[model samples]
Target: MARRNDHTREELREMALASAERIIAQEGLAGLSTRKVATAIGYSVGALYTLFSNLDDLCWQLNERTLSCLMAAIKEVDETDPVACLQGCARIYQAFAEQYPERWRLLFEHRSNTDNPLPDQLSTRIGGLFEHIDGCLARLYPRIDRHERQLRSRILWSGIHGLTQLEHSNKLFLPDAMTAEDIRIHLIDSLLAGWDKESHHA
Candidate 1:
């Protein structure tokens, strides 16, 4: 292992995070460890602790990186129409999950230690992803209250999240006729229709 003085704290943190991501990508969360990350980055496990509070902290940072990447992917969707915006974000989300099953799964599956909740910046990045949907719903229903729009965002996100989770676990294979995209489109359309009905009644 290299001496701690060999690398600045920022460089060590970046190196550790990069190594941890690769481990999760290749071997899943079960294979990621401070020791493993340190070894891969040619540093001591102590170096990781200096940068992160604990293993959970390390995972939290890893999730932040994943969220940032996911947000970038979602942001690429065009703002043509509300339905298209929702569908485009959903499609990009599914593509990200499929492309990096382990890394994507880490965002949802890894839990931070209850004693030390995730940092504020990490929470902000996670919330930023939802903001994209919230913005779409706001445009979709210009008259809806902010709170209502927030609820709509959560509802739509839940639908897409559930679909992807099921697809990832192969539970989406019960009926062989439909592809994942087919289900995704159906979910978005159905959600929009339901919201429209509710909006009309309101």
Candidate 2:
């Protein structure tokens, strides 16, 4: 086993995080432990402590990296057509959730036991998710006010998230009727069409 001094603090931090992610990916959040991470990185638990305050801090950092990956994935989608872009973004989000359920759950399902709110940086990064959706809505409906657009983004995301949980639990009305994405497509189209119809009637 390599001594802890073999690597710089930053390198050790990265190594620990990577090891932790692999452990979590295979066994879910409950499987993660500071000792496991330390052993995986060939370092002592004390050395791991130097990198993170506690397990919660480690999880927080893990979630931060996951969020960055998600945002980058969204940015990679072509946005020439806002409508298609919106649908593409939705699909990508769903794909990410399905591919990395444990990581995705770590972002949301895993919560710190502390009473203190999350770091402002993390809170702000989470807000970016909703803001991205808001921007997409602006392109689709120029006349929609910011407040309304923000609310719409939340509503749309809430629906998608709800369906995702239901899908995973096999709790949807029709067990094998359709995928969450299929229902999401119909839901999005119906909502968009309803808005267009409302405008016409107005």
Candidate 3:
């Protein structure tokens, strides 16, 4: 009976999250409220409080889940070459944004002003992606100092994130402008070129 109860609770939590995602997808973040989520999930507001302390907590939970999914997708790449791995990571990141625009927006668009730290699990999940990029840099430029490597990694992450945001938001499509794929490929090439130039100097 205890096991069954636990299972049911887990299901309810999942349902609540699903309903929240649906609401966000349909009407954006402004549409997400405790009362609306409760109504959408056919649960009382008190029931939502059982799973999440407040609507902000629910938003954080959703963002964490989205990041987890993105990290998982990136980790699935099996390329052996370091440069190829980096490119693969870029492709996967773009794919995630294109495939899950709403979730992507929640993960990157919604700025949180709170001083609250991310849960350790979510931090580790995002850290893994950075670690992977750091590993590639180590292989590409073995003589670089730790500080230099960190700087390069941050640059790479920011470049990719910016390009992904532009492409996903359809901002790349100006009058007689490039397609999303064109922008993605160009950004990836530019990043690879920059890395190659840096490695030559290093």
Candidate 4:
């Protein structure tokens, strides 16, 4: 290990987070522990606790970073057309899962306790993702009222999420063997078609 003074507290915290991410990616969240993170970062467990309340706190911070990374991915989708943009968002999400399976899984699967809920700030950050979809839906159907846009956004997101979960779980057994991307595009296209019908009816 390097000399204790070689890194400041802020640097040590960054190191610990990075090391914890690696451990989770290789061994999963169940395998993560403060001791492992401290050892990897050349800091004592007490030193780590000085920066974070506990392992749960550290994991929560990591989850926040993960969400930020996902938001960045979604933002990078270059399409402006509502349907294509939404489809691109789904494709980017699937790509993120494939590229960082462990990190992505931690977002949905990690829980400190079954009864305890996330902190309000974290919950709001998670909700921002839904807002991204809501914005796109609003652009696509400008005449739809805010309540209807919110409802449609939630419904479309659920469909995208369901498809992603099925793909990740590897239980999407079908005779035709459609890939995840294929299913994502089909879902978005079908939803758009239904929305068009609704708009015409209104």
Candidate 5:
């Protein structure tokens, strides 16, 4: 029988990440540890160190992965109509947060001091999303100045992020309980209404 290389470096790295996500999902970020990840993956702590320098590094990788997935979802939105594209983007953003609460928390909720520099690939991934939004705004109102278009895009993004964060934290209060989907749709409508008013004023 051929020798079994039960643990390659790449394989171990994948296992460590999977374990980290599992731990975060089950017990929240406070419960995640290198030792726990190693144990979960049947590897020693040293093995984890060989792949990642520290828990922060591992978490950074996980956050990057989460962002990549979010970007992909945003890119998948249809762009036929500017308002529809913005609404779709907003819906996708909230859906990601609701579906992967722990991962989303790590990505956008927590403020990390670690110098987890975003890789070029990840930067490009996010830039594409912004570019699509900008394109949509430009198409909707060709007369709008470049600076105003950028401002509107930023405002929309900030609105979606704020609402998603509030909803995820369960701190959002209305007359009645609102599902994430409902909140997403409401926010999109508000954004579009503001955009329409601005367009008419211009």
Candidate 6:
């Protein structure tokens, strides 16, 4: 390892996070540990503790990056119509799960090693994702009041995540059936139709 003073605390923190991400991507969360991260980052376990409270904190930070990456992907869909934009973002989300299956699973599937709730900063990042969806749904159907729209966005997000999890588990289809992408698009279309009708009655 290089001399301890070669890197600042902030730089060491970044290095540790990057190393942890690489380990998780290659070996899933099962392969992550403070020891492994410290070894890869050229810092001792003691040094790592200076950066993160514990493994869970590092995990939350990694997941925050994953959320940012996902939000960036969906925002780049480049659709003009609000309905189309929302649908396009769904497709983008589907692709993201395919591209980074482990990272995607880590965000939702991995259980915490402790009982502590996520930190306030990380919790805000998670909520911001739903808020993004809330905005999109509001734009698509302005009659769907804010409270109602927020609830709907959570439902929509959960449904898509469930579908993705099923796909990863190799249980998305029969011998001959619509692909996962097809099913996702169909699900979105059906939900949008129902939401549109619901808005009129609001």
Best by TM-score: 1
Residues 36-83, candidate 2: write the lDDT tens digits. 999998989998999989898899888888888898999888888877
lDDT of each structure?
Answer: 0.88, 0.85, 0.78, 0.83, 0.79, 0.82
Q: Candidate 3 lDDT, tens digit per residue, 1-202? A: 1222444777878888889989888888778888898887677788778888877678888987887787888778775888878888888988888777887888765665576676677677777878888888888779888888888888888988888887766775556765655665676568768878877886
Instruction: Give the Å error, residue 70, model 2.
Output: 1.1
Itemize residue pairs with steric clashes in candidate 5.
Answer: none
Per-residue lDDT of model 5, residues 30-107, tens digit only: 898899998888777877788888776777788767877887888788888778888888888888888999988887
User: After best superposition, candidate 2 residue 8: deviation in angstroms?
Assistant: 2.0
**Candidate 5 error regions (>4 Å):** 1-5, 111-122, 143-146, 177-183
Give the RMSD in angstroms, all C-alphas superposed, for model 4. Answer: 2.1
Name the better of 3 and 4 by lDDT.
4
| Model 2 misplacement above 4 A | 173-177, 200-202
lDDT of 2: 0.85
lDDT of 4: 0.83
Instruction: Please write out the lDDT profile of model 1 over residues 82-199, one tens digit for every residue.
Output: 7899999999998889998988888888876667866898989978988889888888899999998888888888988899999899887656677999989988898899989998
- In model 3, the Cα lDDT at residue 12 comes to 77
Candidate ordering by lDDT (highest first)? 1, 2, 4, 6, 5, 3
Candidate 3 lDDT score relative to the true structure: 0.78
Candidate number with the higher TM-score (3 or 4): 4
After superposition on all CA atoms, what RMSD does each candidate show versus the true structure?
1.4, 1.8, 3.4, 2.1, 3.3, 1.7
**TM-score for each predicted model, relative to the true structure:** 0.94, 0.91, 0.83, 0.90, 0.81, 0.92
Of candidate 3, the 10-residue stretch with the lowest lDDT total is 1-10
